[model samples]
Target: MNTSLLPTRHWLLAAFLLLATPALWSCNSQTTLQKQLSEHQDQLKQIDDDTIQSYLRRNNLLTKATKTNSGLYVVNLVDGAGAAVKTGNQVRMKYVGRFLSNGAHPASTGYPASYGDPRYPQGAIFDNSADNRTVCGCAVFTAGTGLTAGFGEGLLLSRVGDRKLLLVPSRLAYGPNGTTGIPTDAALMFDIEILEIL
Candidate 1:
């Protein structure tokens, strides 16, 4: 038995143990952080849902609004006489994109619940097809791809010339990677009118 080699072996064992311990701790810490983020998102989702219900009730739309299986609320203002729209059909339309008048409180929107969002007034338009027509011809999009998931779902429920008001939750809106002026997990609203289905 070489005494010098024995010391080297002991030092190597100690070094291995020290390195392994921190790696294990790092994995545990990462998992904990991920769990916390998920919980926070869940809380925000619940808050948004509650606010949507309150808005519907206060506006007397609780009974009038049709809640789709996936949670999009639609108010069919004008029923179209034209043929029903299909999944891949190209459609010409007009739309006004707006936030929910932001019923969410400071917990999500950073504003008091009593005072509505000044930037996004009750009916103020954040985006509209008339303006976008110069850009990508916003008045047109394929039934399944051009719009957000909730928006597409709403369109599928309509026929050419149908006018609808869609209440889209954040999960179905821009989602985590928000669009310009919109934040993460924000529920949105859209006033849409189908001009023609091509």
Candidate 2:
């Protein structure tokens, strides 16, 4: 039997049958979902951009504003409290960083918490877990230097025993893309107490 012997009407009917298959319907749904997903992502990007701008605009360290140069704001806190430090500088600090959107504090507690023991559960936030770290001790920013631009600027405004709150905009805190736990184009607030400068 020759396959070419198929009738034109039969071929037309076969084509129609394929065109109206359930798979085509599934494709339509997937296409619609993809379109919606694209639109949602675009909206999210716009929102993130807007949020960054709004935060930057509203940020005015006027009370502690010292200088502004190269897109960096230098704030000098009163009483030499939580001030800025330069890179490679050894400093002792008790810092607490919190997300503006949520009160989740992200700090490496430098200590370990006892797990599974009810008597003396970890006293501090930092537990013995491999992930938990304590940032309370003195840290020397060596080699390439350390801390974010905003944090570096913050040190300059601090004295050995000063304690001040640093309100860092995203541009000053983490820039356009922030670190983990911090959203993209986000504004960060830091409450730093300068224990001692070594």
Candidate 3:
């Protein structure tokens, strides 16, 4: 009941509340974001599954395409006669990447210095090797460098001269946070040809 202390007490209370506001807001924002992400992930998974199934049914590839344990769908278009690639082996490959939703290519011409091929036709091809004169040069990378879970796994399953199609879910591709040109939660399709393994 001290009149002098009342103003000081009120100021302290206001300071405490102001200091705690950001923390409270941050907690709520993080929780909401997490929930949204979880829902988005679930939705993307279902959409990817449906797209893959529909693609298989439409193309009569239901029996030809094999589903991996990690949810990737692989269809071997051509079985290679060369040696199979394994982890740590450097690989040279040509690929065309497309989004499963609308079958639009994400890789555009004139971005990466190595890319930008006139043969691809702008907005038609995503990524391709220069050998094909499509989009870019042949992709050279180690077998298991974790560049992309889906692509890496698919590559390991293929051999030199092998051509395969990979259906990659968002989780294995870019997840909810897709890169530029690739939409968030978008599924992807990759047509890859293994040129060499060194």
Candidate 4:
């Protein structure tokens, strides 16, 4: 028996095993973490969907609400007869953007004017064109640009004077990285009245 080589071989085997163990364990740990994150996101999405559905049901808009391919819900509260608003058109709108607050919202406030009071039943008003109109004239932006993806899509579906309640899922708005006012995973509601295709 080559005793001298035997000990060296055993030592090498031990070193390799020690090195490989952590790599194997790390992959397993990463997988577990990924699974947990995916599950958490799924739960959040379910909660958001439920909240929107409940709001629609409460407002008797379930039948009228149409969900778009990207998961935007548009309820045409007041229909207008005119040419369909197109992308790149300058549109003037009166909009109140809020999150269908989950009761304990931090309460978004401060606008060109006083931000509307936020109560659980009323939801938090992040922005209101009604408040900003005097300061800037009801929001006049080129449609399909400089707006959230959901908002732009909703505009494309409207004509002049169409009053729409747009329920925008987080995925369509800000996704995981929310903007300054919108919270992560927060579903948004835009009560927008198309004033004109300017």
Q: Please list the C-alpha lDDT of all candidates, in the order they appear.
A: 0.76, 0.48, 0.75, 0.76
- Candidate 1 per-residue lDDT, tens place, 1-198, comes to 678899889999999999999999999999999998787667656665665666788888788898887788898889889988899999888888887744343345442233444655644567888786465445887998778899999989989879998988767887666777775556788889988888
Model 3 agreement with the true structure over 1-198: per-residue lDDT tens digits: 569999899999999999999999999999999998777566556666776777778889889999999999999999999989999999988888876653222232321111222333323545566656535467787998966799888988989989999988768887656776665555678889998886
Query: What tens-digit string does per-residue lDDT give for candidate 4 at 1-198?
Result: 768899899999999999999999999999999998787566555555666788889889999999998788999899998778998999988899887632212222321112222332336788888787376448887888898898899999999879999998766777666777665656788998888876
Candidate 1 vs candidate 4, TM-score winner: 1
Choose 2 or 3, whichever is better by TM-score. Answer: 3
Rank the candidate models, highest lDDT first: 1, 4, 3, 2
Give the least accurate 10-residue stretch of model 4, judged by summed lDDT: 104-113
Which candidate model has the greater lDDT, 1 or 4? 1
Candidate 2 worst ten-residue window by lDDT: 108-117
Q: 37 in model 3: Cα distance from truth in Å?
A: 1.2
Lowest summed lDDT window (length 10), candidate 3: 108-117
TM-score per candidate: 0.79, 0.43, 0.76, 0.70
* Top candidate by lDDT: 1
lDDT string for model 2 (20-91, tens) is 887889999999999986664454334433333343356654555443453333333436644446556577
TM-score-based ranking: 1, 3, 4, 2
